[model samples]
Target: MLKNVSNQQIINVFKFLEAAWSTTQIRSISYEEKQKKQRTHAQKMIDMFDLPTKKKKFETRKPFDYSGDFGELEPLKDDETMFVYRGLEDKFKEFPQNYSKVTSLEYADGQEKMAHRIWTMQEKFLNICKYGERSEMIIAQKTIQIRNLKEHCQKNKKDTLARVILLEQIQGRKKELKKLRKRDYKRFIWLLKELDLLYRPHPLYVDLNTRRARMRQYLREETCRIIREKINAVYTRLDSEKENFYTEKEKVLSEIRKDLSDHNISAYDVLQNVRKLRQERVVERQNKAPPTPNTYRWIQSDKDRKKAERRERDLHRNALVKKGMQKLAQSEEAS
Candidate 1:
């Protein structure tokens, strides 16, 4: 089935799958983080919504015992913290729309697991939506690609900096994500309004016990439609991603070749030259400049002038030379 698929369709399906997966994964996998945050505020929200009021406010003793100091400071209590959690839950009524997948789960290093969980949800979502091959990863799997490039560079005697350029490209994408946030929030807000109209009246949304602002907008039908469209747009990028990989690979390879030329290193001599260049810079930094002559006008004819200039340059060059290389050459006339 994978073989018969046209390249264009493949790109389309991949993008289709990515968008499908990103949204689905983001929505489904996020519950864990939401649950954790809500667990902290469960008492307050239950009280606010006039739901069953069994849960108690988590209480605590004052950290600092004070009479007059700190202007009669109030004790730091768990109810305040609980209310903050309630506030967040209230503010993010459309929690499923705005939050990315629960990046990190409950523990400190659960971020990777959360990402994987998101991907898994996306996979299942694609299966439901009929997007692409069930096995296709939404985010391109780049570890093998990155490692292979590194190994190739090491074997070919290429510069390490040239080999790592693609890795830098991945890290630099955060700026692109920050740019996305600006536009994404507006879209998110629009989605929230839609949800308010449609889902807010649904039993699950209102009874969430947290009063999300969007639930008041009465726009659930529009919210779902807009999100569906956004998912389509994200899916379209899969083809672009493949093309991006091709371009980035070409760029890195071209740069490696240019690095050799830039340093005048033969492939066989690259390592040897790298060592020599560092030694040269160290010596150059240590050495003092030779004093210049008052002028190279000795007996002022072009040939004598040329010879004088060459002699001066060679003397200075030899003074600056490290143990390995030849001095700057003297005048052609001297030869």
Candidate 2:
């Protein structure tokens, strides 16, 4: 085969091999990694003119601190939530006692410590011979459980179930306490006092939690703020001008005095007449006292309404007695 092969044929074969190698080499070339592209002119134009796209965030306002309205209020120095049981540990020696001989809570197991706490609560809040089913007793039990669970949660952050249970317990306790308060206020007071708990009742109306409501509140606060600022500014301006105003008043008084002299009237006699007029006006005002407001009628509590009625009755009786005395004095004068 080599003996019969022409130079052209051999050259053609070599050319075909070179072409195959070139094709293989082209196919073997790997793809380059994509790079970040520069922004196009159109994209830049859109960015320059178009509004930014963003999530609509809810607007919230800070509630005004009305605590400052109370001038002499003292802030709590210690944690009020951590209720301290007052009395000697030994004094809790009676019926419904924790029979556990574990003297030190430091060495006691979780269950034993919980039982001891419940026993202490029962000792303080439970009535004579009453078991642990009372609302107060239940609240006390749940409170202890919540405190323990809170401690556990702090130690083991992954205990999500405990946290959920803690929240549910708190909500349930709150509802129970609210019911107890409504059903028997005196009992509620006693329970609160024993537990050293602050009774913060929920608002009568549910908060709408809408933007409109928030905006309305914000506007009302703003209006009040503006009014107060304007009033303060007016008072400040008045104070700055007070001296000049008093000087002008003196000048007017002197002119009035001169006029009185020209009219053959004595200033002393005039002042005495003015004093008598003022006294008579004051007496008339005292006799025509304003009637009592019925604002107390808006109070929903029956006890409060009764008390207000009693007060009004007393006031009416006092007024009648005062009128009778005045009439008797007039009759004596006529005699």
Candidate 3:
């Protein structure tokens, strides 16, 4: 029996079994089980849709008080004071010199350092006189916190809680920054420049999670790639054939020149004369003196000049409208 068995025979048997299985009626479930399954699925969908979309409440961390005068503290002068305020001064100078005047930053713990950093960022973004709780200032503070948390998470690796906090801070900062941008674009730009941040806005229409969206993106990318490749191929072909094209063009030109001479159109070549004229015009333009700056030169016929300018403006507007219409038509056709 084993000797008689072949691979094709085995495959045929499997295929027949598969076909039989496909034709066989499915096992019917009880009404209660069916209802229960449907209910569970419906509840899952309902829960998904009912989930709250409210924005997360971000904690507003107070800016560290950097007002306490550390110089007022009477300590031993010179070398001894340097030892007492060694690491603290350099680390928390931005925080309050008082925190350092008391003890070193490493001994005072990371909280002081974090406060100092936030204060530094706030001082940079906010007004010097009054460090108000402006959106830009808050965003700047969050940005520093995010950076510090990110660094800590990277070093620790197992600190998942820190990572979560970092992500929350990032999202909060992003939302605030976006709001700030909408409220005041100039302030937003200034804040970003001050904080050394690059704002990458989210897409308006595309959701990359869906299969359809992903396929559309892939199709667009492939279309662009194909177009670029085809253009390059066409250019390469043209370059290869240009020598022959130029030779033929020269022959046709010579024949045309001969015919023109025979017809007594002109004694000298008209094209040659045109080329000389173009070169002379270019040379004249190059040699022309530039107009003086900060001085208005009065032109003759100012009324005519104003009329001509208005006419040119109208012509330009009409041309732009025509171009825009053509583009709209092209887009409609493509869609």
Candidate 4:
């Protein structure tokens, strides 16, 4: 039954059991550590007499069933082969046993007692073997499927290693995308907006036309929104702490006042200064030499202007002809 089970499966089982046992022990130790106080006499005595502590005798090593030099065997392609071999070698090196010796007993009905004991021993051994075989069968089946999958991946254009690397990268990107979407989405949008504005003429450098005025309005709204958010965060932090609430509020107000003063503006008269700044920027822009004209653009503008003049002349000529025709008809009717 054990022949069907791969070395890797056995090693994996042992490793899992070891890890789980270690974790249990760690949790138990942590709980005890949190107590801080010393253990009671009864608890200490119980720990001393625990089955794990009492069982100390090393088990005898079993001889390997196969009698071949492992070194002579070809190296396995799978990365887990060496790990499995080491794990199995370590496990078989020393096995613990609970009892050192077995006790014999005598009975009045000797033949019947001996027969019953033999039957019971055979039954126990069979049952143990049956369970072991069942476990081995399950592990062997799983190992076969895993080997098939590995073989399939190896045969395909995209091997397991490449697939694993790709999957890892995709997972990492997904996490980054999730963070961007959740926390930095607004900032990301704002950055895109700024990039778009970079390609266009700046409102301060251009005449305050309808479009420039609208852009300036948008910028002002964004600035106000940022300031309001900052003020709200400060308020929230202050509100959370009950001590010196009034004092904190006053300090926040003083900071705001100082910021406004630095900008040469007052809180109540902010709009006036903002408008003045806009006018000053527009004047500065107007004072600068105009941009050099593009030759092609200038030619296109001249053509458009001539077309408009021609259309106006045609309309005027048509109106004069209509008036002359109307006056002739009235003169004919009067004659």
Candidate 5:
């Protein structure tokens, strides 16, 4: 039963037991001895709790001596300097917590402000020492980074980020291809063939070559055509309705113009008269129109009538089939 129990559950049980034991009185022991036993028990509980250990502090390395051996190496060119600085910025952006450690580093320049920047450059150089140039690990790391960047670009709809990611992916694929070519030419050729076939049909079309597949494809095309035709028909109907509405509106406007013209009124007076007449006609129509019913009783009744008709048709068909079977049986018996 304990095997299935979690460490936390066990710890909790132990805590409850400790609490229960503390509440009980022990008359035989002195106060000091009882206190010492309690302290020992607490220490044991602490050990059993399995609390997190403190992390080891990062040790600062001694500053490099530029005077004796190298006498200060040549300063980086503008482009190189910018590249280095950019790389440092990227590293800090990736791991902001590491920035504090870099700032704490002792430097002779009295510019504690620049220590983080210097630390970034030093860390990059150290990484190069630990992991040689063009290491497989570095390539794998870059591939992972590019993949993440691609996902980020896709989510955020960043065109520039997408382009950069695409470029990186292409370059990474080229490197992999180059390596494959050097290691195994056959595999390299196979990969090239695979890439070529990415958008094109496979050489062996076993599944798609069948008559059924052809028929299915034809059916799919026919279905799409039918749907397109239906959509076009609907659009045509809508267009005709719109044209009819416009024509009717034009006719009404013409009648209004003729009516106004008969009065020999000014254009402004005619417009005002048209508006009044239109409003009066609208009010008259509203008054003449029947009031809407509270419920859709007519629609419900129509549906019930259709259902009854369908049921009658089914009953008639079933009766005719049964009569025909009985007649066939009688003919068989007479024969």
Candidate 6:
């Protein structure tokens, strides 16, 4: 993301570059001074970008991040229908989430098959396709949804939590005497898997995926696409807001740098210098290690697992928050 600046500044830089490159008249600029002039030009653009300077101010939390996956962005296309089905194959998993706005893969065989949309191209129409119908401004896509998954365990009276309590009463004999018939082994395996908590997908998602597609599959895809667009709009708005904030901040940063001029770094110059210092150093690997065989290790203690998980979650959250805050602050300032 760009640091900050205004639309006007952007215009000047663009115009300067155009003029400089046009017909090689080159504005009679010196070769040695070219880089310095470019820097000044860019800084002017940044400083001139109009940003908000009101009571709303910069934000400390709730910044934005890249969300390309959510948008169904993919590599360059194969053949047209091939690209379409590839999209379907690629995003069948997402259909259950009601996520992607573009699905060329015809989705027939119910929403349950959203896990793997199988299409048979013959004289017969293969499957329900997720297509789009574009209007003047909107492209409507199909949407698939699961009705409901979470009914209270209290109402059902047969929850895992209850079963766990019962197992505890039997005194840690988790490998209990199920003693089912050999013929019913598969059923027992299903029951066992259903009983496991961590292994399961979210109940709501599972419910949605398991259900049949009530609406046309293409309609579902189109709906998902629309929703995806809405989500994108929200993020784009946030970006614009942040852009405005950063543009506003250039002047403030410049002012602060002016106050510290005795330190030998002008605001823009110091910033550019900071950018220079932040460049990554090329590293050469010296310690080459051989691949090790996988070993079956026992699980860590619950406390240790919990601590590690907590730490991981905390770090991830902190990273996200920090990024968002910085973006939000700069955007607000630039605006």
lDDT of each: 0.50, 0.68, 0.70, 0.51, 0.58, 0.44
Candidate 2 residue-wise lDDT at 272: 99
CA RMSD of each candidate after superposition: 39.8, 28.8, 24.5, 38.0, 35.4, 41.3
Q: Write the residue-wise lDDT of candidate 3 on 1-335 in tens digits.
A: 86899999999999999999988969789999999999897667546544333547997853221111111112223222233344555566577756555564344446766665566556665554245548877876787777666558768989889878877887888899889889889878877766667777887875657645644666688789999999999999999999999999999989988988798887467778999999999999999999766433455467679999999999999999999999999999999
Residue 172 shift from truth in candidate 5, angstroms: 14
Best-to-worst order by lDDT is 3, 2, 5, 4, 1, 6
In model 3, state the lDDT of residue 281.
Answer: 100
Better of 2 and 3 by TM-score: 2
lDDT of 2 by residue, 1-335 (tens): 79999999999999999999888785533333222123354356446544333547997743212111111112222211112333444444552334322344544566766676677667766554366448878877777776677668768888889878877876787788899988988877776665555555678998798745755666678789999999999999999999999999999999998999899999899889999999999999999969997876666577787999999999999999999999999999999
Model 1 is weakest, by summed lDDT over 10 consecutive residues, at 64-73
For every model in order, what is the number of clashing pairs? 12, 0, 0, 0, 0, 37
Candidate 2 positional error at 39, Å: 19
Model 1 TM-score (2 dp): 0.15
Better of 5 and 6 by lDDT: 5
- Once model 1 is optimally superposed onto the true structure by TM-score, how far is the C-alpha of residue 264 displaced, in angstroms? 4.6
**Candidate 1 per-residue C-alpha lDDT over 138-237 given as tens digits, one digit per residue, 9 for 90 to 100:** 2222222333344455566556674566456334332333343355655334423422211111144444443464333335655787899998888888
Any runs in candidate 4 off by more than 4 Å, and if so which?
A: 1-294
Worst 10 residues of 3 by lDDT: 64-73
Q: Pick the candidate with the highest lDDT.
A: 3
State the displacement of the C-alpha of residue 300, model 2, in Å, after optimal TM-score superposition: 49
Instruction: Give the higher-lDDT candidate: 1 or 2.
Output: 2
TM-score of 3: 0.37
Q: How far is candidate 1 from the true structure (C-alpha RMSD, Å)?
A: 39.8
Residue range 174-247, candidate 6, lDDT tens digits: 12213322335554455334322111212454334311342244457768999999999999999989978998
TM-score of each: 0.15, 0.40, 0.37, 0.15, 0.20, 0.18
lDDT, candidate 1, residue 323?
32
Residue pairs with colliding backbones in model 4 are: none
Best by TM-score: 2
